[model samples]
Every structure is written in C-alpha cells, then in structure tokens.
Target chain A: MLALRLSRVAHPAVQLRRLAVAAASAGTGFLLLCTFGYALGEPEHSGAAVLRLSWCAVPLAATVYLALAVARTDPGTRPRPGLSALGLGPGRMMAVSAATTALACSLGSLGALLLFVQLRGGLRALPLDGGAARVLAAGRPLPVPATLTLLVLVPVVASVAVALSLRPRDPRRPAAGRGYGRFGAYGTAGARETFGAYGRFGARLRSGTGPQAPAAAEGARPASGAAGGRTAVAVPAGPAPGTATVSGPADALAPADGPADTDREDADGPADAEGLGSEADPHRPPAPRKPPAGLPWGVAVLAAGLAVEAYTSRAVTLSGPALSGTRTGSGPALPGGLDVGSVPVLVGWLLTTFGLALAGPGLTHLCGRLLQAVRPGPLRLLAGRALMEEAGRIGRPLGVVCAVLSGTFALLVLGRGPASALGPLTALGTLVVLGCTVGTLLTAAVEARQDRSATTAALVRIGAPGTTLRTAAGLRAAALLVLFGPLTLVVAYLSALPLAP
Target chain B: MVAPPDNDVLWARALHFTHNDGSPALSGVSLGVRQGEILAVGGPSGSGKTTLLRCLSGLVPAQRGEVWFNSTPVHTMGPLARERMRRDRFGWIDPVPALVPELNVWENTALPLMLRGTSRRRARTAAQEWLERLDVGELTRRRPHQLRQAERQRVCIARALAPAPTVLFADEPTAPLHRADRAHVLRTLTTAARSHGITVVLATHDAETAALADRTVPLLDGRCVRTVHLPPVQDTEGRAACSLSV
Candidate 1:
C-alpha cells in the first residue's frame, strides 16, 4: 500500500519511466498470449507451437530487463536516512522496488488480457471493436490455467530479478570480496578498491554518498607558510628541476619549468608510462590508460560467434521445413526464419552479444585516449578523461545496444528479399529488444551523471563557462558515435552476409 | 545611476538576495576590491559573505543591486554573458575541494586556462608550475581519489590561480585543510595573488586568514558592520598590523 502511495506521488519523469516499463510488460504479455493462441489453433502440431512459445523468451527477457532498469532508477525506492526509523531501510526499499515492478507488470498483464480477449471476440457482448478473430484463433478455447500461468510469468520473473539486483550489501565488507555481481565489477576489487563501487552495473550505491574520492594527498615538501616563504620556494623539486626561483612575487610569475623542460607526458605518447605498470610511486609521472580487463575474452567470443554464424550459413542442411515455405517464420535470431533451426544461429548471436558486452569498456577507454590524442584543448581533455573514467560504468550497456542494433540491421537487410518475411510477432519481438537495450543504456548514463554531480558542481564553481561543459558533453557523445557507428555497420554486414539471398 | 569606482576591479552596491524559499540571504551588502588587493569578507555562516561573493562575481544576480567589474555593469548581463565574464576575468574556490574525479591533478588545475582556449601543452606547463608552487607538483598525475583533502584543496587553488584571473573570489578556501595546512595554503594563495597582480575577495571567519588580506569587511546578518585595514604585508613581511574603521 505504501509502495502504491509512493508511486502516485513520484516525480513525473519517474512516472514516465514506470509507464514505459508497463508498456514493455504489456507488449511481452501480448506476445505470450499470441503464442498461446497459435498453440490452441494448431493443437496437432504441438512441436511447432512449443517452438513458437519458446521464441517468446526474447520478449520476456527484454521486458524483465526493462523492469529491472526502471526499478534501479526509481527515486522513491532509494534508501534515505529517516526511512530506516520507519522500517523502510535498504532491505525494505529493495522490497518496495520489486513490489512496484510486480504491480506495474501485473497491471500490464491484465491490460494485455483485456486487449487479447477483445481482439479474439471473447468479449462480444461488451461495447468494443471485437475483430480479428480468425487471425487470433478465437474459435479454439484458450485454457484458463495455461493463460494465467503464462501471464504471471513476466511479473514474477521481473520482480524477482529486481529484488535480487537491488539487495543491500553489508556495510563493512567490500562488494568485490563477497562475489562479483553482474558486469564483473566486484570481481576486480582486488585490483582497484574504487572500481566496484563506481562500476555502472556493479551495485546500487547509497544516494548522495555514491563513491568516495579518497582525498589523502600527502607529498614531501618544505614547510612553506608564514615562516619559510622564500626558503620553501627555493627547493623547486623534481617537477621543475629547472631553477625557476620562487623568490618575491615577480620571480614566481614565470613558469617553474621553461618550455624546454616540459615533462614527456605532455606529448601525445605513452612514453612516460613505460615503467609505471600499476606501481604506486607517489612521485612518478601518470600511467597510460588502464582499461578494464575483458577485451581479449570479448574479442575471442565475438570471433567464435561470427565464425559459427558464417560456417552455419554456408554449409547447412535444412532438416526442418523451410520456414518461408510452410509456416509463419519464428526464432528471435532469424525473425523471418529461413530454414535455420533455433539452436545454431541463436548460439552465434548470444556469443556475439556477450563478447560485445565484455569488450565495451576497453573500446570506450580507447575512445577516451583518442579524444586526448592531438593537442587537445580543455574541452577535449575533459571529455576524454571523463569518458575514460566512466567507461566501466557505461561501456557494457553501450555494447549491448550496439549488439541489438547490429542484429536489427541484419534482420532488416535480410527482409529485403523475396524469400525472407517479417510477421507482426517478429516485429513486436524486435521492438521489445530494441526498446529494452536502448532503455538500459539511457539508465546507465543517468546513473553515471548522478555519481558525478559533485564534480559537476565543482567545475561550475571554478568559473568554467557553461558552454565549455556543454561542448565537452557534445565531444564525448560525438566520440562514442564515431567509434561505434562504423563498428555496428561492419558487424551488421558480416552477420547478414551468411543469410543474404 | 550610481557608478562603481574607477580603480576597483570588482564592486557590488546595495546587494540584496533572498533564497528561493523566501529566506533572506543578503540585505543591502556593499563592497569593493582594488587591483592586487586581497580583501577578506569576514563573517559567520549565513552572514551573506558567500552571497555577496556570488553577486560580485556574476555567479548569481542579486534581487536588487548593482555589480560592476572594472567599467562593465554586471547586473545587466545575461546568464551567458555573465558566464563569459566570469570565465574570462574571475576565479573561485569553495570551502571544500571539488576537483573533477576523472581528471588528474594537472589536468584539473589547468581547466580554466583550457576553457579559455589555451593549448594543452601551454596549459599543462602552467598547471604543473602552479601545482609545484602549492607543493603538489609530484602528484599532478594523480586523480582526485588519490589525493588528501588538503592536497585536493591545493590543486583547487592551483586551478584558480592558473588563469591569473582579474578577480579571484575564495570562500573559506582553507576550510578543508588542517590548522597547520590552513596557514600554509592561505599564505600560498595570498603570495600568488600578489605576485600575479590578481585582485582577491576572500570570505573567511578565521582571523588568521583575514590577517593575510590587505583589508577586511566584517558582515553580520547580510550587512557590512565594520571595515578593518591591515598594514602592507609585503612591507611588514611576516608581521601583521590591524587598523580598524567603522
């Protein structure tokens, strides 16, 4: 009841996101119902009915993913200080988020039932447009038990996933030590203390205290203040080993290190980072960009996936009747299925997706490095550094989006043929996949921005022109577009090459 | 149409500001700083020192007041124009350090210079130099997460100083540092301003910090109650002599 009350008073933007989740749920529920209709209509062909039902898994997964994203971002469910006094702590909030998700999904399922019943002419006595009975298998009786079970599947799966993902962690124990949550962020805790806390999909951090900056900057220096003004300035340290005296106000105005003595890192090269290799020198120059580990695995998986797809396409025997020849084509991979079985092509696409998710952070890190490559001005350096910093958090979702786009592109390209065809179910399934991937990406981006609100406020405080920050954001977006656009196109072409007519 | 003084780099007159919630922040505050002068606005919290700084620096427009930077009337400028003015001519430091987590010390320090279109190489050289001055040059490659509170504040100081803005507004700049670190950071800030010929308007409740400034405007409940002028610190070197005026 509290959850429902909170939902009513939520910010409009939060309400919009919830509505989207419901819409996604409704779409998935409708797809499942359609599968049921097909099953009832073709009772003799249980094998084909089961295959069609199995294919609904994609939309179901998409809806669950969307629900989880929405739950993660819901501010009303975010744990707050006084909430614990009212038996509404992190654990309670987790439950609330899950319950809210279940509620939305349940509402969607009910809507889907109404729409399905109306479309199938089951509610003929009601005043509504009750048409499309033949297409929906209306004459065949839809079983109550089976329909209820199928309808409940989305809410149950989605709510459970939401609860598990938002489960509170023990304050004392580090996340990475217990077990790596999804995205392997916690798995890398032994590597860097800060990685897991800041990873985009790692954990739901407490609001306002997302991640610590660990500001303990102790360095060797002469005592300077009121006592040793001139004496302190004289020991110009290794940074300038150049004797730019810090005497009176006049001498300090000149650069400590003249142009000739600039550090090697200033140039567009990794020469300064050659020997650093993760060692904490305190005084050594900065290291080169250290992208999150998983690039190799991602590349290998992607290669294997594409290899399987290409091989299967070139030398396959169509044991099942060609989908186009006999039945309404199915299978999430080949939406308008062209004689391909579910297992082989699906495996290839799954591998490709997993590989891309694994490799996303590294590619994003590289893009950041590229932004700072040539004599970058402040905007480029800021955008590049920020991109590199957030690659872990944003990369995986970005990769998933890229994978979905590639698949959709391949499907559309393949559909431009005489043999390949897209039925309404296939299009609906495609819509769910696209919407969920894009929604997840957007949610991750919002999380990243919230995590850095302090930094943004500080930047504004230091007289940084508003346009500079805006331009930096633009630069980061452009950099990502440049890197991912061509990669997606190439991947799409290669995946489609195998099934092209 | 009352006008600002010709020699004052930053001037605010009859400044009044009320919070969005209708709580009064500043009421009829007025002050000015000469070129190369380090003027401290000394007040307890909620005394309108920060609000006065915000108005004078063109960060926020006062509800009813006049602000002038040199000859330009800042009160009439649009948000964009005020932003441009602040970027080109002013620097600010918050009580707590707030360096960009993603940027290394040098990159963070060089932000303002770069924002002004300075090349990365030149900006870096200047940033490293200022960081060296603040005794954090070795840590230029380190990100904000690696630095101590004081170190990050030092970097923030470096960033403010890198551009050598016409007016530097520091609101309790050394509040984050330890007692020992505060004096050192304050001296560094003042010395850098004097050397660069930068005008500074600092807000602090600490007498020690105010002593470093050439003059002090003490505020209470959004109004200046008294003005305290200190003898030239350069002439006295480490010794401070106060002369009070009401």
Candidate 2:
C-alpha cells in the first residue's frame, strides 16, 4: 500500500514533504538532546540558567515543526512517474534542511533571550540577591520545569515567526509597482521579472534562436532594392535557428533564409505589400536584441570582492595580539572574548559561512551563462526532451519512500520515550504536518489557476486554441497530493500513538 | 519509371500541430509532398502556413494524427528517433535566420550531418565539399554574419542540400528578396532539389513565386483552393525545355 501510494504521488512535492518532515524530526531530535542533557546533569538552582536553556530549546523546536509542516503542505505535484526523485536532488535537499535548521535555531535563541530578560525584570522585585537566576532555577525535582519551559517557548516563538515570514505569497495577487511605499512588493516583482527574463533567455538559447541570425544574413541578397540585382531570398516556414523543433527526417533538407533575405521577405509579405505602407512601414526598426550568451561581469566582481574580504579578514585575525594571558586593561577579559587563541576557529567559521552563502547563486549564474554559450542544436533538444520525460517518470516514487521512512523514524522515536511524552509529540507532529500540507496545497492551487490564466492570454495573443482543461487537471492532481499525503500521515500517527496506561 | 506510392509520399499517415502556449496552431493538418512533386498551401496570415512545416518536422505537436516517415508514424517514436528522422528525412530552412552566426560557413553547412551523430571531423569534411559544390568554398571560414546577402543565401542553400533530405519546405523563401535576388534564389532552390531527387514545397503569396514551383496549390483562409501546373524551363545549356509534371 505504501509503494502503491508512492507510485501515485509526484516526486518534487514528495521530496519537499520529506524535507518538512525531516525538519520536524530535527526538532524532535533537539528535544531528545535537551532531555538527555537534563538526565545527565541537573544544573544548579539558577533562574537565569534555566530560563536561558528553555528559551533556546522552545524556539528551535517550533521552527523545525513549522518548517516541516510548511513543507508537507507544498501544493505542487505532477504525475512524474519515474524521474520525480530527480526534481529534488539529494544535495538540494540537504542544503535546504541545513538552512532551515540554522534559521530555526537562530530565531529560537532570540526568543529565549527575550523571555529570559522579561523574567529577570519580574524577578528583580524579590528579596534575593540573585533573584533573576534563583527564580529561573526554582522548580521541583531538579528545576526540570523551568528548563522545559524555556526549551518549549524558545522553539515555539521562533517556529511561529519563521512560518509566518516564509509562507509562500499568493502568486496571483497583482504585485505592487515600483515606489518607496511599495518597496517590498516591488522587490518581489523585480525578482520575478529577472527570473522570467532568465528563463526566456535560456529557452531562446535552447531553441537556437539567438546565434543563427548573422549566418542567415550572409547568403541572402541585400534588403535594399536594387534593379537587375540578385533577387531577394524568401524566408522558409520551418524552425527558427537555435530553437528546438520536432521534425522528421524530411525537415533536414529545407533551404533557410539569410538575414538580408529574411528582412526582404518580411518587406514583401502581404502584410507589408498591401502598401498599407502607412501601418506597414518597411523602415520600422526591429526590436532591440538581447545581449549574446555570456557571464555577467557583476557576479565575477562580487565574487572577487568577497574573496578579498575573506582573505584580508583572516590575515588581520592571524596577525592580531595573543590573548593566552590575562588582559592588561580593566578586569580580566571574558573567557569567550575574541583573542588569538580563537582566531583560527573564528576565521574558519566565517569562511565556511561566506562560502556556503555564495555557492548556489554563483554556481547557478555560471551554469546559466555556460548553457547559453553552448548553442542548442539537435543534441540539446534530444537531451532536454529525454531529461524532462525521465524526471516526470521518477519524481513521485522517491517522495513516497522518503515519507514512509520519516513516519517509521517518528514511530521509533515516540516508542523510545515515556507514555506521557509519546502522546504530545505524536499529536504535535501530526497536526503540524497536516496543517502545513493543506496550506501549501491551497497556495499552489491558486498559483496554478493564475498560470492557466496567463497561458490563456498568451494563446489568445497568438490566436491559438487553449488547453485549459488539461492544465486544470494537472494542477488539481498536484493540489490533492500535497494536501492529502500529510493529512493521512498525521491521522495514522495519531491513531498509532500508544495510549497512556 | 514511376515511384511507388509510399516512396513518393513525403510524410506518411496523419499530422499534428501544437504551439507552446497550450494552443493548437494546426490541429492535425496533414498532407503529403511526393517525390518529384511540389505541394503548396495558401492561407491568410495566421492560417498556419509556417506552422505546418513545424508540425511536419516535429517542432510543433500534432495534438492528433500520426506523422509518418516511410509509413511509420514519427509521433509515436522517442525524441532521439524523431530528431534522427528530422535530420535524415527532410531538410528544413525557416524564413528567419537559421544559420549559427558564430559558426563559419563550413560549420553551418554541416549542422545536419553533425546532428545525425556524425563525428565532427567527418561532418566538417563533408561540409567543405558541399560548400565547394554550392560555389561558396571561398567563404568557408567566414562567419555567416560577415558574408554578403547573396553569399548568406547560397550558404543556407548549401547547408540544406548537404544532408540531402527527401523533402524540403521553404516557407515564403522568396518573400525577402528583390525581383532579381528572388528569381535567383528560387531558380537555385528548384534546380538544386531536382538534381538531388528531393521534393520541394515553397509557400509564397506572390503569384510569380508560385509559378517557379512545378505545381502550386492556393491556400485561402485555411483550405486548399486550387492547384496549378507551370510550364517547364530549359536545362543548364538551354538545350531543351524538359516536360516536368507531378
């Protein structure tokens, strides 16, 4: 039944769901860590310490759970049977997971700090010298209550914030145009426009439309009217240069027009020849051509700048004063303060963080440029077609496998804990995943509907017959998979949770 | 000797046409261009004259109907096989610039051969010979953008003929050229196909341009209205007018 379900689901959505599940699992893992920490050594009776730990743990947990839920609800499923798994590569999955974890941890920490500060302020009213610390540490049976409270609150705040912030915006909403008041909206629109432009450029390259113009100009007669000169060549009605066109063996032999001929032919076409020359002005300039395929220099410059900064920062740290001994200045410096001893570690961390931050954008940009340079012809068309088909086939099965694994892991973890723990954890995971899946599906459905509308507009412009029904069907299947899969898993988990004796 | 019905047929079986925007450009418009025959479709703008060529070559989708190659439907085949069919069965040259401008004359001419999975070295060698035959050998190393108008036309013609497709569709091939260049391009196209035993379909609005084809069919709106046969022209030496009929 698991295999059957997996077979029906698309791959990318499943992978996305798995990622969400993994995030939630990480939160569970963090909880396990805290529980184990408490079991190992109970901290002294200090309210501040207990508050700090709880604040940290709570947010981490919340972020992970929320992320998982969000992932579960991603409403983008396609019936890609065999190659669905390829949609979310292992590397991409790991990266997304790591980033989500870090973000959750950071947010949780901030929330915990805020609560710690608030509690400290309230505790100041007490008579104790270290009132803030004592109150945090105060709790029956080894101050576990305070610690648990901090752990739970920290993750909850962080998770809630992240869930709200990262929620995918409705794609159909009319994006705000440029201006200061609408800066956020405009930024999103700009990013979308850039993405669309890049996609179009890539498509043009894949289609072989960019590089062929120059070649076409050479063979045909000049566009300028010359009496008794070589006749202008007519444009052929076949595939554009550099564009992918499906054709049988017969298409390989047609005569193509040169640039000069193409221009002349356009001039002679019935639209131009009707001497509607007023509307069909022969001298009308062609649309501005986009830049040829190559890497934009700005990215390279930015990369170089980052590299220089990284090197200089590392060098400065290495050459700075040693701090093995006590500081000459007022009172002994804090143990964790920046010093020569910690310089190497700090440098390494900085380097790693900077490298990680730049890797995806740099690589993607470079690859896009490279792909552009390599003109698409017969080979690219064949490869692209094959890849798309294969991806469509494999995308769904992988998602199901991942989901099953996640479910099994959750069950194992729940079983290992006390009965009291099992009920809450199971319920929490199930509800989170279900809610996220539904939200994601709703978002995706709305977006798909908008896409269908856009496609309709484009078709109308070209006077072509639309395929709304087919597109709608595809989107519907996607929405169902995204929404139902997590809901089912959550229900199953809740049902299977061992009841308290 | 008359060719077999199947041999004369350029594309066997049905046809399908689909545009990118989830729209049907030519909804299963199918017809055949036989060996030694010229087939024409005349239509108003947007009647899908250019689209028909795209469908025949698999650039567009049929959405329905089988696009057969030698009686085998190409629509049912895999992408690689379909590409191979495009490379080896029919030569296509669109009205727009189709030659890779970055590539020199030889590279552009040998594209089809290269696409057929031919080795680069071998393809270039064959391309060189074709350029020579097309009388554009002097421009072999020149990029397409650097060549003159007439030179570019000849180079495209050379590229199309190099792979020797069974049938060729020239969509408004004479539309861009002046009277003189137009005549020269048409003459070159027809004569070259005749020698290679390739069928040609030249879609044009000009009546004079249609007269250049062995047979012309008027396409009004989206339907075929009439078919006309033109008188034969003299051979290379102007020795005699050959009687050509399809």
Give the winner by TM-score: 1
Question: How do the residues A1-501 of candidate 2 rate in per-residue lDDT, one tens digit apiece?
Answer: 322243245467555544443444344444333333433344442442343344334324334444544433333321222333765433333333334434444444444444443433434553533334333333323354644554454344544544454443432335434244432344443443332232232532332343344345333222222211211121133344112121211122122323434454343344433433223432222222233222234234334533544454455446544433323344322112322333343333333223322332233233223332454443432222222222212222222222333334333443242222333334444444444333333433344344235323322221121233344344334433454356335523432232111
- My TM-score estimates for the predictions, one after another, are 0.78, 0.38
Q: Chain B alone, TM-score of each model?
A: 0.90, 0.77
lDDT of 1 by residue, A22-125 (tens): 88889889989988887787677677677778878877887888788788888899988689888998999999999999999999899999999998988867
User: What fraction of the true interface does each of the listed models get right, in terms of native contacts kept?
Assistant: 0.57, 0.02
Where is model 1 more than 4 Å wrong at Cα? A82-88, A125-128, A140-142, A171-290, A317-335, A340-343, A415-419, B226-246
lDDT of each: 0.76, 0.45
Off by over 4 Å in 2: A1-501, B1-7, B11-31, B58-69, B73-81, B100-104, B133-136, B142-156, B174-184, B227-246
